[model samples]
Structures are given as structure tokens and as C-alpha cells.
Target: MIERVLAIRHDKIGDFVLYWPALFLLKSALPKASIEVFVAPAVQALAEACPYVDHVIVDTGDDKATSQKFIERNYDAVIVSCSEFRIYKMIRHLDSAYKLAPKHNWYQHLYKHTADAQYKQGEACWRGGCMLVEHFLTQHGIDIPELPQQYWDLSAERQKWRSYYGQEGNEKLIFIHAGTGGSSGSLSPSDFANLSTNISDKTQVDCKFVLTYSGAEEELAQQIFDQLSKKSIKVVMAKPLSSLADFAKSIVAADMFIAGSTGPLHLAGLHNIPTVGFYAGRRSAPIVRWQTLSHSDRRLSYTPPIGKRTGKNMSLIDFNAVEKDVVAYLDANYA
Candidate 1:
């Protein structure tokens, strides 16, 4: 039995969140195994919060030291998920009984010739229909169990949400996320203004618009809030969420989620919240990969080509296409 494991995935918030299912499966398969994770420092808190993880080692620029530390621990196996040259090199030097990672022909030279196992990440596509997380775990001989979707749960966050927007029985909450990091996933200020106006003009319900985004998008969030305020839309911006659980709770409380293809969209799916995804440049890859829950519907503005160069060559989709989908979703689900 695998008594100790090291799972390495050093990526963004959404990347880490998507691995929840795999983490669950690993824990179930080896209940007694001490699972340690090597992750970006920003996401170290998330790894520590996971009940399955026994320890978390942050990748703070000292690859040799990190590998040495793992060697000393005498881990049974190491699972590498990062697609970085530096990370692959470090994993190759680690002394583990078994090693598993996504197979890439280009990087074969970086791994030990006798590496115990190598799993291809794309195996999910051929498995008919399974969540990417499940696909990853199954490759490692782990079975996924039925678990309530994972979310970051923060005690004070709920209270803060309640206090900021007085919890009235009649209030209808609609969450809007307007910005993405350095991409067209950000709605033009005018598009956001138009959307907020349209919602108020068409709906008679006691509607409120909630703004959510990382601190990096503060300026854009403010712009959207100001536009909605002019339309007399009740707007609330909670402090940036402290954990994935807090973000999930905020999405769960909403009647519907309207956002670009970003972290909130995925979180909405996890919570089974109905969402209108306003994808910017092209079709989102994750939406196509995972089977949507019964409550979810995806409206892509631009259907990207079916190849590796797809998203790179696409131009911005017409805003009218986005407006139609959002309006249709709101009318059907909310009205």
C-alpha cells in the first residue's frame, strides 16, 4: 500500500480547485497514506486546508532544498502535475519508490528512464465522460467517491455577506463577475453597464447585483458597480474571498451567476448553480471537458475551431451574441 505520497500541482487558483476530485480519490484509495503537496506559495493555504493532506511544502524558488526535504521524508510516490521544465527536473532528482506524472513525449529526457509510472493527462478525453479530476485519480488506481462538491468554507465570511446585504426574504440575488486577469474575459465597461440596465428594465423582481473579483480587478469592479448604481440596482462588493470555500458559498447564495469564463464560473458549476458564461475570445476548454450538472447551461459566444491553435486565432465574438444568451438564460431561469 502506498503509505506516503507527494502531489505536485503549482498553478493558479482555478487549477488547484479543479483537482479536488483527484485529491478525494487519492485519500480514499490510500486512507492511511500521508499525502504531502508541493504547490505555489499562494495556494499553500488551500493545500493545508484539505483534510486528506498530511503536509504541504511550498515551492519558494529552492528546488534542490525542496527535493532534498522530500527525499529525507522517504515518500512512497511522487505525483507531478506542473508542466514546467524546472519542476520536471526537480522531480527527476527525488528519491521515491514510484513516480507518476502526465506523459509528454517532448519532456521524456527530463524524467528518469526507469520512472515507475507515467500517466497521460489526455486519457480523460478517451474515457467517454468523466470529470478531469476523476480521470486523473483513476489513472493512479484510485476510485472517486460521492462527495458533496468541495468549496472553501469560512465562518466569518457568511456573517460578512449577511451583514453587508441585509438578509431579507424577498431579496433576489444575482452575482456578476466582470473582470479576468489580462484577457478579453473582462467585459467592456459599456457591456457591463448595458447588462445591468437591461436587467433592471426587464425584471420587476427585487433584484440585487453582487460584484466579485480578485483585488487586481478593483478598478473594473468599481466601474461596473457605479454603472449599476445609476440604474438603482442594489450593489454589494464583499471583500475578496479568503478561500475557495468562501467563494463557493457566495456563489451558492446567488439566484444565478453571470460571469465570463473564470474561477466563479467553475465554482458555480461545483455548487450546481445555474450560470450564464460570457466567454470572450473563444469557447472555454473546461466547460467542454466536464459534463454539466443538471442545473447548468453553457452559451458560448464564439465556437472555437477543433484544434490546438483554436483559441489563439479567434477574434472577439459579437457582444450581441452574449447579450442574447444572458437575456435568454435570465428569462428562462429567473423570470
Candidate 2:
């Protein structure tokens, strides 16, 4: 009987959110056990907010200190989701009977058992990584379910956010983020405004647009807002979110979210809000890899043509296609 477990994936936002399903599996497989997570300092609050995790340890920059925290946890199982060699070495003496990770470089030999899968064109990071976690459970005679049983009970937050936003029953709320064009390119400010205007023009339902952006991207966000304001349709700049938690709370009130394959898009996906993600058509950041990890039926992902991989051509992605699909989603859900 596993009484305690340790999961390590000290990484960035998109990287961190990818592990939610695996964490779900762990909590479900051993319902009575305590699940502890080691994540980066920046995401400590996000990890803490997850329903599955009982305790969160922020990664200490000091190696000895990090190892001490791991040893202190008395975990019966360990799951390594990060590829850092430092992480592997820190857990070298994990007293756990089970250790699982993906089969990778010679470093993978460190794990007692490894999941057999390669990160390739056909495989998504979340699915491939979850395979490692799944293999560990199956070996121990635990059944892997067809779908992940994980979602935050954000109903209370949603209600409060709804009241806070003063959302009436009629209008469809859409949140948009146009940043770094999925980190591989840039979608011009004019294009963002055009898409916003098109959504309003195409949708029969009354629409509201919230241009969400971080501190650094305020100017870009403002530029999009300025462009949209010039149109007859209404667009508003989102109030500064005090923290990631704040942004997450606000997402609960959204009808649809649109973004390049950026961090906030993943944040909204975690909430299972409908999302439309724009992705680059590069092998390293393929549509399959960076697609918003949401409920399959709730997301629409668009990638440029095979030859149009460069950032300069991101505008070539059809606004008509985006508007049509988004309006369709709005029609189905809200109309």
C-alpha cells in the first residue's frame, strides 16, 4: 500500500501544466495516500491550488537542501517528469520502492523502471509523459482509466468571479492573448483586432472581448485593444491580474478563450474553458505538441501550412477559419 508519493516536475507554466493528468492518476490510484509535489518557486502557488497535491516543496537552489527535503518526505513512490540531470541526481537515494520516468539519455538508467516511449512527431508531451506514470501504475496492478479524473472544483471561485465581473445572462465572454505568436512567431496587432471584429460580426450572440496580457506585453495588448476599439464592436482591457491565481479565477467566468500557444492558454485549458490556440508548424513546436491540453471537444487548434513555419507568415493563418470555428463553438454552447 503506497502511503506517500513524491512527484518532481520543476519547470515553467506550460511544462508544469502538462503533468496534471498524471497527478490525477496518482491521486486516484492511491486515494488515501498523501501526494507531494516539487515544483519551481514561480509555480508553487499553482501547485498548491491543485486538488490532488497534499504538500508542495519549492525547489531550493541548493542541491543538498533539495535532497534533504525529498528524503524528509518519506515517499513510497517517486515520479520524475523533468529531464534535468540535477533532478535525477538529487533523488538518487530515494527510499521509495518505485521510481518511474521516461526512457531517455543514459541518465534514464537512474530510474528503477522507465516508460518505453519516445517524444516524436506523432506523440504529444502530455500523453507521452503520462505514459511513464501510467506504466508505473500498471506494473503494480493498477488499472489506467480511459480519461483522466482530474478537475478543480472551482464552482465557488466561478460564482464569485461571475458576480465580480458582473456577468449578465446574455453576453458571451471571450478572453484573448496575443503574445510572441505561440513563442515561435508574432501575430500582428492588426490581425488580433481583425479576428476580434470578425468574431463579433460573425456571431449572432452578443459578444464581449477581454484582452488579457502580462506586464511585459501590455503595450502589445493595448495596441490590439486600440485597434479593436476603432471598430464598432466593444473590447475591454482586462484589469491587472495580481497573480496567476487571480487570472485562473477569472477564467472560470469565460465562455471562450483565444491565444497563441502561450502559458495563459494552458491556464484556461486547465479550467476546461473552450479555447482556440494558434500554433507554429515547426517540428520542435508542432501543433500536436503545443496544442492546448483541454477537454478534446472544447478546444480548436490551428497551425499554419507545412511550408509556412516562419514567424513572418503567422498572419497567413486564416482569420475566417478562426472566426467560423469560434462562432460555431459559441453557437453550440451559448446560442
Candidate 3:
């Protein structure tokens, strides 16, 4: 059995969130093994706080230093969750007896003599057997009883929200998250302004709209906040949270969440909160993925059906379509 494991996944928040199952499995299988995680600086704080990890190393963008640090660790096993290329390179530098990596096209270069296993990411089993996280564990001869939708305790986070809004649990709270990373077309400030204004005008509920995002999207967040202010929509911006637990608590305390396929959506799923997820494209994958793991959420994609096949183009999803679904979901679940 492996005695020490070095897990590497230096990527986004969602990437880290998806791997929580795998981390739990590794710890359960090798109870005495020391587990160290390697992640980007942005995610280092979360990794350090993970209950399953023994140590967390931040990637400083120095290949030589990183390689030397790995070499010095002398781990008995290295499980690279990021990708095939990183696994291959890291294996060559380590004195590990086993290397585990997800299956990909680049597997041809892996050493034949070393103990290796093929893992499939995002695989779902009908008996709840296979999933991206379980596949990794099964490859390592470990079986997990259940895949937990991971969450962090946000009692403090709840307090933050309450203090910021002066909310006494009497007023209805609606959180609108418009910050999605990468190339996804996030809701424009004007769109949020219109939606919040329309909701307040049409409904007589004592509602408050809060906008949340990582500081990276500050400019866009500010624009949305400004637009909502002019319409007299009670808007609050979430300051940078110190931990995922804080973030999860804030989401759980909210009455309703309307956001993109980002971290907040996953948080809502974990907390069993009623959520409306807005996707740029109309494919059912996001909904299917979330629904398989959660019970109290709805997904709305922009892509429309054409003939026998669904359109792949995401541009077809309009602002009106998003607003309609949001309103419908709030009416059905929140009302």
C-alpha cells in the first residue's frame, strides 16, 4: 500500500471543488499516509484548510524550484489530478513507486514498469458507481460509500451577510451572481439592472438583490452594482472571502440564488438551496451534472433545439430567455 501521496491540481475553484471526493477517498484508503497537495496561489488558502490534506505547496511559477521541491519530498506515490502531461513530467522527477493519472491521449509516454492506473473524469454510474472522483479511487483499489457534495461551514459568512445588509431574517433576499470566468458571456450590468428593477416592480415582495464575485471581476461587478443602485434596488457586494466555508455559508443563508455555471451554483447545490443556473449554451450537460448530484436547483441554457439536434451555438440564448426562467423558478420555488 502507498505510504505517502502527493496530489496535484493547480487550477480553478471549480476544479478544486470537483476533486473533493477523490481527496476523501485517498485519505480513507491510506489512513496513515501523509497527503500533500499542490495548487495555485489563488487556491492555496482553501487547500491548506482542507481536512484531508497534510500539507499544501503553492506553485510559484518556477519550474526548477517546483521540480526540486517534489524531488525532495520523496513521496511513495504521486497522483496527478490536473492532466496527463503534468503527471508524466512529475513522475520522471520523483522517486515514487506508483503514479496515478487520469486517462488521456498522452498516456503513450508513461513508463511501462511503474505501477499505473487509468482514471476517467466525469464518469457517472447508474448504481452511483462511477464518477470523475470515484473513478480515481477505484483505480487505486479504494471504494467510496458515497460522493459527498462538499461544503464549508459559513456561520461567520452568514453573520457577514446579515451585518452588511442589516437583515433580520424578515426581508426576502435574492442574490444575483453575474461573474463567470473565461470566455463565457456573463450578464451585462444593464441586464442585471433590468432584471432587478423588473422583479421589484412586478412583485410586491420586500426583496433585496446582492451581487457577488471574486475581486478579479471587480470592474464588471461595479458596473452592475451602479446600474442596480440607480434603480433603487437594494444591492450588496460580497467582499473577498477568506475561505470556501465562508463562501458556502453566505450562499446557504440566501433565500434564492441566480448565477452562472460558477462556484456559487455548486455552493447552492451543496447547501440544498433553491438555485437558478444560467448557462451560455442550451446543452443539458450542466443541468444533468448538477441534478445528478443535487435535488433543489434548476438550470437554464441559451441554446435552442433545431430539428433533431440541439444547437451548439451559445449566442442564441437571449437576456429575455434568462429573465423568464429566473422569474419562473423564483415564483415556483421561492413564492
The lDDT leader among the candidates is 2
lDDT of 3 by residue, 201-291 (tens): 6654567877777766667678878987877778777675767656655675677777654566666655555666544343434433433
The alpha-carbon deviation from the true structure for residue 1 of candidate 2, after best TM-score superposition, in angstroms, is: 2.1
lDDT of each: 0.61, 0.77, 0.62
Per-model TM-score, in order, reads: 0.74, 0.92, 0.75
Candidate 1, 12: how far from true, in Å?
1.5
> In candidate 3, which residue pairs clash?
122-132, 282-303
Worst 10 residues of 2 by lDDT: 303-312
Taking the tens digit of each residue's C-alpha lDDT, what string does model 1 give over 70-99?
Answer: 788788777765556777777776677666
Which stretches of model 1 miss by more than 4 angstroms?
109-165, 182-184, 241-250, 283-295, 298-335
Candidate 2 lDDT, 1-335, residue by residue in tens: 88988888898877777778778888887789998998998888788888888999998699898898888888888888776788888888878788777778788886777887566676667776677778878888988866552365576677767656556668777888877634434677888888888889888888888788877778988999888887766777877768776777678877788887467777787788888877776646656676666777987877666564453377778778888898888887888
